[model samples]
Target: MPVTELTTDAEALTMTLIADVDAPVERLWRAFTDPRQLERFWGPPGWPATFTEFDFTVGGRARYHMTSPKGELSRGAWEFVRIDEPQSFEVLDTFVEADGTVFEGFPAMRMAYSFEPTETGSRLRNVTYFASHEALEQAVEMGAVEGSQLAMGQLDAVLHDLREYAQGKGTRTELLDDQHVRITRLIDGPQELVWRAHTEPALLEKWMLGPDGWRMSACEVDAVAGGRYRYAWEPLDPAAGTAFGFDGEVVLIEPIRRMVTTEHMTDTDYPSTLNDLSLYEEDGATLVTLLVEYPDRETRDAVLATGMTDGMEASYARLEGVLVSLPG
Candidate 1:
C-alpha cells in the first residue's frame, strides 16, 4: 500500500490522505492525468472505473463510473477548478446520476491534489473539503477513508510499468462497452502539432488520406465549439471503390487538449456517433485517444467491421511523417 497517512477532522470538515510512491514526480503526475492509468486504480477492488469523458483543464469536467462486481454502477464527476501542471490541482467532486446530473441530497466536496518530489520518488497529498461537519461525517460513514486507501494501494503497480501500457502500441482499440469504443495511437509529435494537423486544412489534407491510391479530395475544417467540418475522399482510380466522406459538428473544444464532436457519414441518414478526442503528451510524444460512442451496439459493430483501426493506423503513420518533416 502506498498510503502513509489517512486522517479525518470533523471540526475542520476535511479528510486527507497521503501516499508515497516509487516513481518520479513527472511519472506520478502522468499516472494521475492519464485516464488510462487513472482507471486502473481509481476505484476500490472489485469496482473498476471507466472514464467516459475526461477533460483535464480548468473549468473542464470529467465523467466516470465505477462498476461493482454484481454490475451495479456508481457514477461521479469532477469539475476542474485549478491546475498547476506537475505540481497540484483541485476539483469540485460530486456524485452524479447516469446522465451526469448531480445526485440530489448527495454531499459534494472540493478535492485538492498536490504532488511533490521526494528523495526516493514522489509524495501525493489528497485533501477533500466538505461543506459541513455533517457532510464530513457522512463521507466517513460511507467508507470514504477505506475506499481511498484501497484505491491508492493499487497505484504502485500502474506506475511501475507505465511504458508497457501504450507507448509503442500502434493503433489499438478497446471496446469500452456495447455502445462505446476507444481507439488510441501514440504520435511521435507534440500536442500542438497534432492538434494543428487535425484542424488545419493544409496539414490535414497531407495525412488524413487513409491508404495509398486514395487522396483527400476535399478538406474543410472549422474546429471550434459548435463549428462544422467536412471531409471527402476519392480513389486514384474510379474502379477501386466509391467515394465517401464524413462530416461532424464540434460539440466541445479545449484547444490542443480535448475535443468532442458528433460524426456521421456525409449525406447519409445513419445515426451519428459521438467522438471524444483527447491529447496527452509524455516524453515529447503525444497520445491520441478517441472515444467513439455509437447509437447502438449494432452500429458500433458494423463500423468496426469496416477495418476502421487499420485505416486509422495508415493515416496516423502518415501523420507522423508529416510531423517529422516540420521545421521544429
Candidate 2:
C-alpha cells in the first residue's frame, strides 16, 4: 500500500482543500474576491449559484444560495473577520434558509483561508473551526466526509478552468487526475491467486501500471506490523522522468485480509506515515478497500485523484483477465 502523508489536524474541523490553479495567488485571489467569478464556478456542477448580497470586506457579509440539480436549496452566509488582499481572509460561515433563517442544529463556523504562491503552482488552505469537538464529529458523520470530497472534486474542475484561463500548468499528476480516485471493481478469483498478484513482483509487474518504465527493482515483505520491508522500482526509461522509488518499512500487514505499509520515495528510511489496504472475499469475489489517510488533504488528494485509482482498477481488471486465462 502506497500513500502520501499529509496533515490531519487536532482541532477536528476536518476542513481540507487542494487548489492547483494556473494563476498565482493573485489570480486565485481575484477569482475568490470577484463575486461574479465566484458565482460563475461555485458549488458542484449542475448546481446553480445565486447571491443575495456579497460584500468582500471585513465586517461585511456574504449571503448566498446554492440550488442543486435535484431541486435542493442550501443557503449560507459568511461574515468576514480578517482580510489580507490577494493573500488571506477569515470569516464565520453557516447554512441558512431562503428567508434568511440559519439552521438550529448546525452551529456557526469560523474559516481562515490562505493563498500562497508555490514553485510548482499555487496552494490554498481553508482552516475551518467549529464550536466544539462534538459539533465537528456531528458534521463529519452528517455527510461531511462525502461532502468535502465532492467539494474537492468541484475544486479540481474549477482549477482546471482557472489554469487555462490564467495560462498556467494546472495541477496534473499523470493521467490519474487527482489523488483520491476510488478503485472499485469486484474481482472474482481465488484468495491465493489474488494474494500472489499483490505480493509477488513477477506477477505484480505484469499487473501494476506505475508511471511508465516503473519496474519492481527490489521487493521484500514481512507481512505484519512492527515488521519491515523495502521495495525499489526502476524506471524503464531514465530520460523520460525521475527514477528511484523506495519505501523501507512494513508497519502493518495481515496475511490474506489486510496490509498496511509505510512508503517513502527517498532511500533514507526516513520518518513517514502509513497506508492500510484490506481485502474481503464476498460472494466468491474479493472486495478490496484501500484507504490512504494522509496527515493532510493536500498531498493525499494529489495521489488519490491521479489515475492511481484508475491505474489500480485497470491493473486489477487485467489481473482478473489473467486469472480467467489460468487453467481451472
Candidate 3:
C-alpha cells in the first residue's frame, strides 16, 4: 500500500563503490547510457554482448548483448528509472533464469550512478539497492559481491579509452558487426556414407533426434534446389507437452558434395528457428556444420541463456554417436 521512495548510494558491499573514474564526465556518461559502450565493460572479460532494442532513455529499455554456449544470445530489459545527464541515471535491470521461469522478487533495485568532475578526470559511483537485508545477504552468498567487483574493473578499462576516443569519433558504432552462429563437427566415414546419413530420410531417423518422446513421422527430400525436404517430428506425449515439429527447406543440394537446408522450426503454433547444415570432407573425416539462426535474440536466448557449455560438449558427444551409428 506504500510506494518505495527512490534513494541514492545503494550499497552492495561493506563500503559502497565510490564514483571515481579515470575518464572525463562525458565519457563516464556514455559508458552507462550507451548500450555498445556499456557492453564493452558490462560483463566480465572476454564476454562480449550483442545488444538489441538498445534505447537507454527514461521509460525506455535495453538488453545485454550476450550469447549462450550454443550460439544463443540471451537478452533482458533495463527499464529506465531516471536520467540526470552527466551526473546520475537509474534503471531497474531484469534477467532470465535457467529454467525459463521469470522471478522478480526484490529485483526492482534502484541503480544510482553518479559522475563528478575530478581534477584529474572524473569520479564515478554506482550504488545498487536491495529491497531488504535478507536480499542483500542472499546475493552476497551467491557471489554477487565478487561479480560486481569484476564488472567494475572492466568498466574502468573501457572508460579510460572512451575519453580519448570520443574526441575523434565519426558516427555511431554498432557492436553486432559480422556476427553469426558457428557450428563445427567431424563425422568419420566415407563421403557418401556421411552424406547418406545426413540427406537420406531413413538413416537420419536412426540417431538424430533424442528418444525421449520424438519420432520421425515422415522424412522426404527432393535432393535438388528449388526442391525441399520435409520432416515430421511427432511428440509421443502431445497431450502432455508441446505439439509436432516440422521444418526443412533446401537452400542448396550438391550430391556427394554438400547440402544446405534451413530447418523449419515450429513449436505449438509458434515460429522457432532456421538451422543451416553444411557437409564437407577433410583429413578423411566428413566435416558437418549445423548453423542455427533464430527469429530474434529472445528465442535464441531461451535455449542458450543457461550457459550450456557442458550440455553443448555433451551434445557433440551425441553427434559423435550419430556418426558411429551410420552405415560404413
Best by lDDT: 1
Better of 1 and 3 by TM-score: 1
- Residue lDDT tens for model 2, 140-204: 77655455444444343334342232222211222122333223344677666776677766676
- Per-prediction TM-score: 0.60, 0.46, 0.42
- Residue pairs whose backbone atoms clash in candidate 3: 19-123, 19-124, 19-125, 20-123, 20-124, 49-65, 50-65, 247-264
Candidate closer to the true structure by TM-score (higher is better), 1 or 2: 1
Candidate 1 residues lying further than 4 Å off, grouped into runs, are 1-104, 108-164
Alpha-carbon local distance difference test for all models = 0.86, 0.60, 0.57
Candidates sorted on TM-score, descending: 1, 2, 3
Error of 3 at 210 (Å): 44
Q: lDDT tens string, model 1, 100-125?
A: 88998877899999999999999999
- How far off is residue 50 in model 2, in Å? 2.3
Worst 10 residues of 2 by lDDT: 166-175
Off by over 4 Å in 3: 1-15, 65-75, 97-106, 160-328
Task: Evaluate model 3: give its lDDT.
Answer: 0.57
